[model samples]
Target: MTPAPAGLTCRLCGRADLRSVLDLGAAPPCQRFMTADQLDEPEPGLPLHLRLCADCLLLQIPPLLSPADNFTDYAYYSSFSSSWVAHARRFVERAARELLPADAFVVEVAANDGYLLQHVAARGIRCLGIEPSENCSDAARRRGVPVHTAFLDKATAERVRAEHGPADLVIANNVWAHVPDVVGFTRALATLVAEHGRISIEVHHALSLVRDAQFDTIYHEHFQYWTVLAAERALAVAGLRLVDVELLPTHGGSIRLWAVPAASDVPVSGAVARVRQLERTAGLDTPAGYQGLAPAVGQIRDGLLRLLLDARAAGQRVVGYGAAGKGQTLLNYAGVRPDLLAWIADKNPYKHGRYAPGTRIPVVDVDRIEQERPDLILVLPWNLREEITGQLSGVGRWGGRLVFAQPRLTVIDPGAAAIEGAA
Candidate 1:
């Protein structure tokens, strides 16, 4: 595949001293789930070079594909994971108590399946979802949430504001990193938000990515990674102020940042200062903090490959669970093919007969696992291991075990049932 124009400078800070941190080989668009007929066709793969900006402490990958190529007909649905949906429900409740006003207008960018906006609408408040994926947006509209099927940028933000007025609360959860133009994305949110409005951003913390060795989360879809410091810098550059920040445990480790127009009189919350201080103490302010990640990531990849190869050597059938973006990255980077992993099982019908993007492994329904009773089930999305393990606990009856390949390759013994938080 041809390489797209790379961003020579950092997305947050216009610096050219971006240091190479990790190279996980070539990867395709993680969300590009292929159909059964397309499996034999050639797939595109772009260089995966994760770079770190010393100037702003931001971890970013250069732009490789246009947003339309990645998001227009996306296959990812946030409501698939019960835990994630529960997390969104809890977030909506908390926002109602803390940030959201009684009769406020709420807008969520990159809202998939109206997971969070459904809660806002249920509370009798005015809400809208700005999602680029037509399939996801259609699902949201069916759930009674008004949605705009357009990518959020400066122009789209202006049009949204003119049509529906400034939003009292604007949310861009998990989309900030997906945006190619980081500066323009921030400025667009600023345009949609009112002067007194709160702009909430949930991003996977770069510090956590290094600290926890979350290399699987690094894919072509996520263009940038942010620490509190880097995020604050980007927001400030777009005429926004970082008012508050909360470190959440979701998505390995994420930071929910609260911002407002720079000219607002809102006093910055103590949480912001505390998180900044915590990040600084964790060595996020220097280049040494970013060191050692490449090695740890390499170790995990090698370990996972070893387990799969050993299982195949022993004549054990190994099937995978969860056709997630992180799973695609991990499988592709580890050079796992259909022979080693067989097929992956997912509950989403849209992906049931489809093939994985880069690996081209067939995605079958979850019942197929019970039908085949593979000896070892590799749980690809390790973040939802507990939920998935519990759902497939019956596999243990047939002497089937579960495996995970994050931090390290762990094999859960057969008949070992998991509680909600066990994993």
Candidate 2:
């Protein structure tokens, strides 16, 4: 109930009425995967707390770190997840068929490794990517997707607009929540779109975070957790109106927002009102809606720790499946160390030899799962359980079971039905 400290204002509304929702203590930057040489050195931790703005209803955290610190040399590549790439392909195809003109100029912000823009280019459409990470942008260029390696801000938006004219369609997927300046980022998004063009944004819905106790998704890299209400307010700051919203199953749960210039007179889709009502019904329009998350987060932490301890006592070998950001947050917050989880397996070769940021668990290739055949495979990125479960389905041959910690610990047999209390 104490007032937010001076200068701690809402990133979207500039309001000082920021109320604490949940605090996961302090955690190291989730993406700061350390090499074996650097593991001996001290790794710094920052405050990982979630707050809600009473004025704008924006669910956010203090900007403890800058985008440059987190994204300059990013570790995540969108191409690693086959399902995610397929989702991007479908989105691009739908946009081209239903929204874009014959000669539309498409621009995507934070286009990691040209996952989506490659699909645009395959359709013979002129597309460009704005990526901050030099390595990621290099990969994009290799895919024949044009890229501008810079963060999107007002000045950068103006320069891009001046160079290429306003984009016929601008896509900012999964990057909206990572930005600290919500209003400014929305303005940049507006500046990039043509007068009558559409801007598409995809953000993990905060409703799912609270309802499902997805506290693992709260890391320093992600500055905010968005809702349709907060998104509409941010969009209005840039003279853009939310014309449509589509709920997606990706990233646990997400909302794809479609916005257009306010003066464009585009008819608002009924989905907008429907999603708005859902948020309202869930009490996301007010500060009180976030009150239940702190306790839910505690349950997740205790449940995961207990599960790990039980497995270890039973002489079970447990290893993590993904070296994802969410996994880093969950493991670090729950105080899980290498003793509980031997090593994590990831498909991204960039992380194969590195160690998880805070937990310091060695990251190995997916082949390690077959080599070690651990008794339990703790799937960290629970949102991608289906995809990961399919990939690790062969684990059933070795009597290895899969474990999902969030939303409660559920142990499942990869080739059989989920055994709720099997763990």
Which portions of model 2 miss their true places by more than 4 Å? Answer: 1-3
lDDT of each: 0.87, 0.91
lDDT of 1: 0.87
Candidate 1 residue 186 C-alpha distance from true site, Å: 0.4
Give each model a TM-score: 0.95, 0.98
Deviating ranges (above 4 Å) for candidate 1 = 1-7, 417-423
Clashing pairs in 1: none
lDDT, candidate 1, 250-366, per-residue tens = 887889999999999999889988988887887878877777888898888888888888889999999999999999989999999999999999988888888898888999999
lDDT of 2 by residue, 1-423 (tens): 345667798888888999889888888999899998998899998988788888888888999899999999999999999999999999998999899999899999999999999999989999899999999999999999999999999999999999999999999999999998878888999999999899999989998998898898899989999999888888998999999999999999999999999999899999988988888888788787778888888887887888899989999999999999999999998999999999999999999899998889999999999998999999988998889889999999989999998667899999885667732
Question: What is residue 260's positional error in candidate 1, in angstroms?
Answer: 1.3
